[model samples]
Target chain A: MISVLRRELLAFFTSAAGYVLMAVFPVAMGLLALFVFPAVLERGASWFHTKELTMRSFFLAFPWVAAAVMPAIAMRSWAEEYRGNTFQLLLTLPAPSWRLVAGKYLASVAVLCLMLLTTGVFPVMIAANGGWEGGPIFGGYLGCLLLGSGYLAIGMFASSLTSNQLGAYMAALLACGTLTALGSFAGLAGSSGALSSMVRFMAAGDHFNLLAAGYLKLETVTFFISMAAFFLMLTALGVEGRRYR
Target chain B: MLNVEAISRSYGRFLALNGLSFSIGKGAILGFVGPNGAGKTTAMSIITGLLAADSGAVHLGDDEVHATPSLVKSRIGFLPETPPLYTAMEVSEYLRFCGEARGMDRQQLGERLENVLANTGLSARRNMPISTLSRGYRQRAGLAQALLHDPDLLVLDEPTSGLDPAQILDMHELLRGLAAQGKIVIFSTHILSEVEAIASHILIINHGRCLAFGERSALLGADGKERGLTDLFISLVKKRNP
Candidate 1:
C-alpha cells in the first residue's frame, strides 16, 4: 500500500497535469479576488473588508472551479486502466481493493492541497498591505480543503462507473452542479422551512459558506466528511461490482 | 496444486462458462486450447479471482479460491489477453510497483526485479517508457510483470498472441524454461502449432464446455492413426458441433 501511494504521488508530481493544476488554480483565484470583483478591489477598502471580500470571492468561485478541475484529475484514475486493460493486472495484485482506492484518493487530495496552497499569496498580500484578521482566513482555507476533498470523492466515484473518460467527467460535473445549485438564491427562493433546511444541509456550497464565515459547526464538518466517505465507498463498490459482472 | 469444481459464470444472457471443471497438480503446465469465446479467459479470470463465478468453486490446495481469494492470488501470477501496461511509466518503475503490490519486501523486490528483467530479456529497455517499446517488448514486459514474484501458478491468456514468428519462438522457449523450473504455467491459445511445440497436456474447450482433456499424445492418437494437433483440435470442435 505504501509503495502504491508513493508511485501515485511520484506520478502526480512528474506529470504535467499536476503542475498545471497546482500552478493555475490559486493564480486564477488570486486574479479573481484582486481584480475581477470591483466591489472588493476598489480604493479606500479597509484590510478587514478586503480580507472579507477575498474570502467571499474564494468561496463563491471554489465550487465552479473545483467542479471543473477535480474531475480532470480523477477521471483517469480507473478509466485509463480499463481502456488499456491494466485494471486486470491491478486486480490480480495481492493488495485489497480498498488500498488501491485509498492510495489514489490520498494522492489526488494531496494534489488538491498543492492547488489550495497557491491561494496563500492572497493572505500574504493582505498581511503586507495592512492589518487583517487571521482567524477567518485560516477558517476559509480549511473550508476550501474540505470542500475540494468532497468534490474529489464524487469525481472518483463517477470515474469508477465508466471506462469512458468523458462520461466520468460529465457525471462528476452534473453531480457537483446539483450540489452547488441547491445553495444558490434560486434554490432557496423556491423552497421554505424544513425543505429549505434539508436542501442547505445537502448542498456543499451551504456548508462551505458557513465555514467561510468562521463558523465551525459540527453538522457542517460531519456533512463534508460523511459526503466524502459515502462517495469513496461507492467508488469501491462500483469497482468491486465489475469483477462479478 | 489447483482444483476447480463445476464452475459456471455468465454475463447476463450470455453463458461464458457452464459447469466447467478441471484440476492440475503442482508444477504442471496445462494448455487451455479453445476457439474464440470458448470461455477460456473467463475461467482463468475466476481462477485468478479477477472475476467471480455465479456458482461452483475454485480451490488452491486446501483453500477455496473465491472465499479466500487474496491468499490464492498471492501465490499466482496472471497475464490477461491484452498486456496490461501503464504506458506512462518506465519499465523498471512499473515492475517495482507490481512486485511490491504482490507483497514483496524491498530487498526481495529488488532481487526479483533483477531476475525477471534478465529472464525476460527486458534489461536494456528497463529505463524506457512502456509506450516507446515495440509490440514484442511490451509483451515481454507484461510477461515480466507476471513473473516478478516467482509465482507458483502462472495463468497466461494468449501469452504469444499477436507476436511475429521470431517472437513466438522466443515465447515458446520462455514457457518451456518456466515449466522446466517446476512452475505451473497454464496458457490459453487458438494456435495448435504453438501448443504442439510446447504443451505437454491440453484441454480443448468449445462453446464454454471442456470437449477434451488429456495428454497431447493421447488426444492426437497413435498406432499408425497419427494426426497433427490442428487436425485433432478441428475434429474435436467439429464433433462437438455435430
Candidate 2:
C-alpha cells in the first residue's frame, strides 16, 4: 500500500498534471478572495464593519471550486488505469483491492492538501491587516478540507465506473452536484419542518456551514469523515467486484 | 506445476472460455497459440487470478486459486496483451514500481533489477519514459516488468507481438533460460516459428476450447512425423464450431 501510494505521488509530480493542479487550486482561491467578488473584496475597511478580514467569503467559494476541481484531480485515479489496461496489472498484484483504492485516494488528498497549504498565506495576508480571530480562521480552513475530501471521494467513485476521463469527470461532477444540492437545498421544497431539518442534517454544505462559522460540533465532523469513507469503500468494493464479473 | 480445470467465462452473451483445461509442470516453456479471439488472453487472465471463471478452478499445488487467490497471485507474474506501461513513468521507474508492488525487498530488487533489464534488452532505455519509447521497446518494458517479480509461473500474452526479429530471438533465449532455471513460462504468440524454436510444450486453443495440449512430440502426427506449430494449428483448429 505504501509503495502504491508512493508511485501515485510520483506519477502526479513527475507529470505536468501535479504542477498545474497545485498552481490552479490556490490561484483560484486567491482570485476569488481578492479579486472576483467585488462585494466582499471592496467591502471597505474592517470587512463589513468588523475587524476580521473577508475570509468567510473565501470559505464559501472554496467548496464550489473544490466541487469542480476535485473531479479533475481524481478523474484519472482509476479511469486511467482502466483506459490504459493497467487494471489487469494492478488487480493481479499481491495486494488487497482496498489498499490500491486507499493508496490512490491518499495520494490525491495529499495533492489537495498541498494546494490548501499554499493558500495558507492567504490567511496570513489577511492577518497582516490586524484583528485576526484564530478560531474562525482555523474553522474556515477545516471546513474546506473536509468538504474537499468528501468531494474527492465522490470523484474517485465516479472514476471507478468508467474508462473515459471525460466521462469520469462528468459523472463525478454530476454526482457531487446532485447530492450536495439535494442535501443542502431540499429544505426549499419540503413544507414539513421535520423533513426539512432531516435534509439539512444530511446535507454536506449544512455541516460545512456550521464549521465555517466556527461552531465546533462532533456530528458535523463525523458526517464529513463518514462521507469520505463511504465513497472510498464504494471504490474499493467496485475494484474487487470486477474480479467476479 | 499449474493446473486449470473446466475454466469457463462468458461476457454477457459471448462465451470466452468453455470448459478449457490444461496443465504444465515446472521447468517448461508452454506456448499458447490461437487466432485473435480464441480465449488465449482470457485463459491467461484466469490462470493469473485476475479474472474469475464462472465454473471451474485453477490450482497451484493443493490451493484452489479461487479460494486463496492472494496466496497464489504472489507466485505468479503476468503481462497482459496491452503491455501495462505507465506512460508518465521512465522504464527504470516503472520497473522499480513493479518490483516493489510484488513485495521485492530493497536488497532483492537491487540484486535482480539490473539482470531483468539486461535480459529484456531494456538496459539502454531505462531512463526513457514509456510514452516516448518505440513499440518494440515498450514491449520489452512490459516483459521487463513480468520478469521483475521472479515468480514461479510467468504468464505473458503475445509477449513478442511488437518486437523486431532480433528482439524476438532475444526473447526466445530469455524464455529458455528462465525455463532452464525451473520457472514455468506460458506465452501466447501469433508467430508459429517462435513457438517451434523455443516452447517445449504446445497448448493450441480455438474458440475457447482446447484443441491440443501436449508436449512437442505428443502433438506430432500418427506416423510420428515432425511438423511446425502452424501446420498443427491449421489442422487442429476446426473451421466450424463442433
Question: For each candidate, what's the DockQ?
Answer: 0.83, 0.79
* Tens-place lDDT digits, model 2, residues B126-231: 8998999999899889888888878899999998888888888888888999999999999998888888888889988888999888987778553478777777
TM-score of each candidate structure, all chains considered together: 0.94, 0.94
Candidate 1 ranges beyond 4 A from true positions:
A37-54, A185-194, B222-224
lDDT of 1 at B27: 58
- Top candidate (lDDT): 2
Q: What is the C-alpha lDDT of each candidate?
A: 0.83, 0.85
lDDT (Cα, tens digit) per residue for candidate 2, span A36-115: 64455456432344434658767767767888888988999999999888898898888889989988999988888888
Which docking category, incorrect, acceptable, medium or high, applies to candidate 1? high
Q: Give interface RMSD, every candidate, in order.
A: 1.1, 1.0
Report the poorest 10 consecutive residues by lDDT, candidate 2 chain A: A43-52
Candidate 1 Cα RMSD after full superposition onto the native fold (Å) = 2.5
- Cα lDDT tens digits for candidate 1, A1-245: 67767777787787887787788888887666555653454564533456443456656667777778888888888888788798998788887788888988998888888787777777776677664566667777788888889999999999898899999999998888888777775465456777777786788887887888788889888898999999999888888888987
Please give the RMSD to the true structure for each candidate, in Å. Answer: 2.5, 2.3
User: What would the per-residue lDDT of candidate 1 be over residues B1-242, giving only the tens digit for each residue?
Assistant: 77889899999899999998888776577889888889999999998999999999988889887788788888888998889987889999999889877888999999999999998889999999999999888989999999998888899999887778888888888888888888888999888787887887888888889888777777677435878888877888899887
How far is B121's C-alpha from truth in model 1 (Å)?
0.6
